[model samples]
Target: MTQSMNHEETFENPIIPGFYPDPSICRVGEDYYLVTSTFHYFPGVPIFHSKDLVNWRQIGHVLDRPSQLNLDGTPSSRGIYAPTIRYHQGVFYMITTFVESKKGARRNFYVTAENPAGPWSDPNWLEDAPGIDPSLFFDDDGRVYMTANRVPPSGREYPKHMEIWLQELDIEKKQLIGPKYSLWDGALKQIHAQEAPHLYKIEGQYYLMIAEGGTGFTHSVTIARSESITGPYENCKMNPILTHRHLGRDYPITSVGHADIVQTQNGEWWIVCLATRPYGGEYRNLGRESFLVPFRWENGWPVVNPGKGIVEMTTKRPHLKSFPWPTRPACDHFDTPQLDMAWNFIRTPRDHFWSLTERPGHLRLRLKPERMTEICNPSFVGRRQQHMTFAARTMMVFDPQNEWETAGLVLLQDHDFQYRMESALHESKNIIRLIKREHGEEEVIATQEIAGQRLYLKVEAAGQDYHFYYARHAEEWQVLAEYMDGRLLSTDVAGGFVGAYIGLFASSQGHDSLNVADFDWFEYIGVPQQ
Candidate 1:
């Protein structure tokens, strides 16, 4: 194991964890770039960079513009989904689906930039976009093409209804300019929900890669190839090119899909995809995160996990060893124009969701008004949950002498499965309490009075459960609760595409301008003790 203290027994913790899903990767020179699906999260499609695919750092977001990311009343997990990121020439492009509401008001959107972190252009709608998971490929013949999954109107069965379609793309026109052709649908039958088409060209043939099966435990990565970009593409003799299901239900990684391939400067290939690790094989509180797999060509075709046709948790083959892996960024002072790749939102946030100016080196989050039926959008910022049993601690001063003023750390799981352990005014004294909303019911488990100008709060998400612990006046840390089931608060059950997110939040229960919380620092320690 990369870290000895991590008992789950994987090579290492997630490179990028906690809600980072549908990852796509690209390599330019010695630097590697990655982007992931940001459904309903503002600053959509976060761009990350690394020298080694394992140690990634957030560069910036691609859809920071309002035109590119529309969060005006868009439901949680309804805006963007399954983004495919690719780079060509001096430009980087990513495409995703914008599902406005349950009524099925959805469309395809694209954004580009000369640099990953940049002045990304506004969203360009594919005028003929009908389905979802669109990806672009630049061929050797100086042609650009697009491929995606569409539910054919004529499909009859549950499995055959969805299939991949391809068309010629006019970059200058920003749209498809050729006829649509059907590509391989997995397993001939059981592979129904095949989508997220990413294409690559090797030698004289074209390879189409996609994430098939549902994005659940049954998720998989599949590939097919065509001598021509539009012709009949043949499936890989050993399909489901990469997966973890064979590892059985007790394995570490789960729900692997939405992958992107990158070649090292030395000409070696690797794929970065999203995977989740459930604490108890049922609850994935850390959400879907990015992972890496090495690849090579066999008999003129890419063999992801040769012989077995699935990805392994560990491998002996080393990456081409060209450039050094990028250093993971931590102990951030929050002085930059953007938050680190670690941060995530429970839902699409408004303009005032966060800011660094108010606290300078520290992040200042303003609680937005909450819908009773929706997850509350308050001042929140958090690092990805990489370790299954790590601890997140923060020190904050919550003043205002009002019971309505609340500020503390949280083990957040969408709107349904969330636990708030907060510091609030209790009579004339400050009180720290642990409260949880389980199965649509709010319950308080512990409360204590503390005397201090600032309070320290800590939350531990380990082993499929969430535990709250806090200390006042430098006293011994007390465990507030243990084994709080969080899977109950998921989009799968609560209705969204997002997963459980653990972070810090501050908000006022009443309309008062004086209520404020000043946090000193937030830290997440992994199994390696870093």
Candidate 2:
């Protein structure tokens, strides 16, 4: 997809930032569409559109229906893995793996839509496909193939010893036809887990690319090519076409790999991949973010970030003309008919638990039996905390009818690590409390009895510190908890593939309270870096 560039604007790296990772792009005429992994969040695989590669707007999610994605008991970072989006003929196809099957194994599925902003068809499960990071390639002669990583057919020499495989796909029937062929293992001899494979047929030569050395500090992108669609593929002389693993942990950007390549209308080539931004030491709380890098062909091989061989914070925008899209509102007033695309639920939500229309201009969340610390779905709706330094506030009116009922604002990393400033019944008194849960241990840090039912809860983040505040009114904010270590909510500390999410939550703490919390508004404003 190509976009109409009508203006000139300098775009930065991470064109699509904050918890959005493993991005795959496809160009259909003048429009470019991209998809990213959403893990256990419902309405999975966010779809983005751009005229130029730099500026992107989320059009919609590829899996908007519960039937299309089932993450009921799935833990954080266990639902959808890497996804690939490709436009073939008049259809847009997305292929991904669901890692939480009841059968205790990974399952692959594909969905299609006529338009990228979709009512995507229900999943066509690949019953025989046996791996993650599945990608589809449509050749020049109407031939189609699917590629993925799997255990070697011969046997398993060691854990994570895998190979890239290719199989012909029957487009009309949506099934695999020919025998699966083993393509390439990986580039580095010591590296295992060769995954995230993409195929490109350029200038009559078939090129195969894969990510190796896992997805952590050792992450790197490697390339190989063959004259035939299936190899005897030769590894590139300069393997590891792109990576920042060797740059040390202090480089700010690390864990770079799982990339997809695209050529613009003007013939400029680029890649979108996942990388981390370590803040306050080598802890990456933001998780893997999407980054853009430029590339060129040298001696029939692709060379990424040519001069430096590392992703930059700022680079020249793609050759395509620039057309900027409107940004999402910083505050949600609950004034819209439907929730914004930026908001996401922890899992498949109970249809009647939360409503924007029940009370005009307010989001009413009824207390449920589950707590935020449970693995099951909870009454929680949140958006990614995109900025390291930012302020998030919510006005909640909740008079808990029972001691078990609570409603408040939360910075959630997962079930085990999170902080909540909540309004609940404490000793038959209406009080606001600051609670912290680290590694499954819950602690009540501070509590104050409030005179009114309506109160404002805020959390201010600066670098590695988070301060929780509460106020009887919006203007008089008093600190409840000061300089709480925010790194405790980071991915490095939490042990997950997700970033921190600032959201509103309501729960009965495992008891049925039949209580409700109404949120007047939710605001998240970024504090500029000084």
Candidate 3:
């Protein structure tokens, strides 16, 4: 992976702002490696590294290597699901599930690498595991076990019939060895649904940590433990170890769950998981991305979100030792072969569609099929949404003479609900404007003519709303759309496990030739108090 040289100030809250989700973290000898679900974003499973959890840097992607993953025709919301990162004997492993487009085709897969930042091995299919969110546990006795969701034999419907299951695995053969046993059921006695199982053993106790509550604003974190690997596990006396309960219907951090736990150098326990915050109770452009939470053990059970049982916007860093003293670069000038760890695709991405040039320091994105549904095309690329409130800005230059070119920055979430500001040919003249995907139409919300081919566009999402802006001349910036209701762009309203993501985009909806977009720099600023 190519590293950036541009020096930029890194903010604290959104450590990695964009659209990353389903974070699984592991600490190896003073260094931390964080991986998250790609969900159709080819070059799947973004891997981020940090010396200090607060200062994260995109080292590389585990799925970049073909042997690691593949998604030729994967849907916008189907490819990679929740992934769990585990390290055993210096080899790093990630277990996950792939939901095929056809019915009854969901399957579990695994990948391994000697190094966290590496050329990972190809995925190995584990059959008979018919569910999502597969996790691995390598015990001290040199035994490997798998825990995942399985459809109940009685009912065929999902979300209502899924149950957590456990089975021992033969790592050498890449197959299950023993009979599967039922561990727990999500719909047994709760309104919240179950998924994302991460198994581990702490101090002789086998722990099973899972996420429930539908991964929505009502999402929550839950845990269960057993004396043995397959016996009846007991739910935490106080379930929902962590959550943001104070925010009514529209606070920032909504749909937070799907977690993986790790132990720091000081034996401190911490979790890296997914969560989202609407900008003014309206938009979740960054989709459910990654988050960090502290874990404490009380009276033999795990306790998180312990303080008044509410997640906080600003909390103290996890109690872990910090090394790698100085942090890596944050601001990107787009001068590398590989995009930053902060970058991802909504669906599988075609390598030929995007590039980062070193000579002029710009991101060149080739236009893909216009009006392509988010599910199938490999054109989308994005990053994890890591903040409740922030400002994302990018500068781009388009082919002014080309009416076929439409390039802009987007605050994207699934297929519906997204705000876009692009450069297009308007009345034979190049105009920069803000357009939104509302009620399934690309309605023009704001527009302004430009003198040259260069323009800077930005989206600011804070509290529970969003604002769009643009600058033809670098020094003077103009607001296009202000504090628009974001819920119009939400999954609850738009439908998807994702939130909004702000990034560069290009498309040739119905053009004769390919449109090109060149991005100069992308910056994100955490929202400040009024």
Clash count list over all predictions = 2, 9, 38
Write the residue-wise lDDT of candidate 1 on 1-530 in tens digits: 12123233233345676678888777777787888887766667888887756666677878776666766667666778877777788898887888877667669878788978898888888877778788888887789888888877566477435778888888888887868888765557877688888888878888888888778877888888888778688888777878776677767677777788877766667777888776665666666777777688888777774565555555433343323455554456677876665676644465575676788776665543442226445566654555666777877766646666677777655555677888877787778888877767888888887777677777776555767778764446887777877566554455556766667777765454545566666777755412
What local lDDT score does residue 368 receive in model 1, on the 0 to 100 scale? 37
Q: What's each prediction's TM-score? A: 0.88, 0.97, 0.85
lDDT of 2: 0.88
Q: Write the per-residue lDDT of candidate 3 for residues 433-470, one digit (tens) a residue.
A: 87777756778888887778788887776655778888
How close is each model in CA RMSD to the real structure?
A: 4.5, 2.1, 5.4
For model 1, the stretches where C-alpha displacement exceeds 4 angstroms are 1-15, 317-319, 322-338, 346-355, 359-361, 371-376, 426-429, 474-476, 486-496, 510-514, 528-530
Tell me the TM-score of model 3: 0.85
Question: Model 2, range 175-261, lDDT digits (tens) per residue?
Answer: 898899999865555778899999999999999999998888889999999999988999998978898988998987899999999
Candidate number that wins on TM-score, 1 or 2: 2
Ten residues in sequence with the least summed lDDT for candidate 3 = 1-10
Better of 1 and 3 by TM-score: 1
Give the alpha-carbon lDDT of every model: 0.71, 0.88, 0.71
TM-score of 1: 0.88
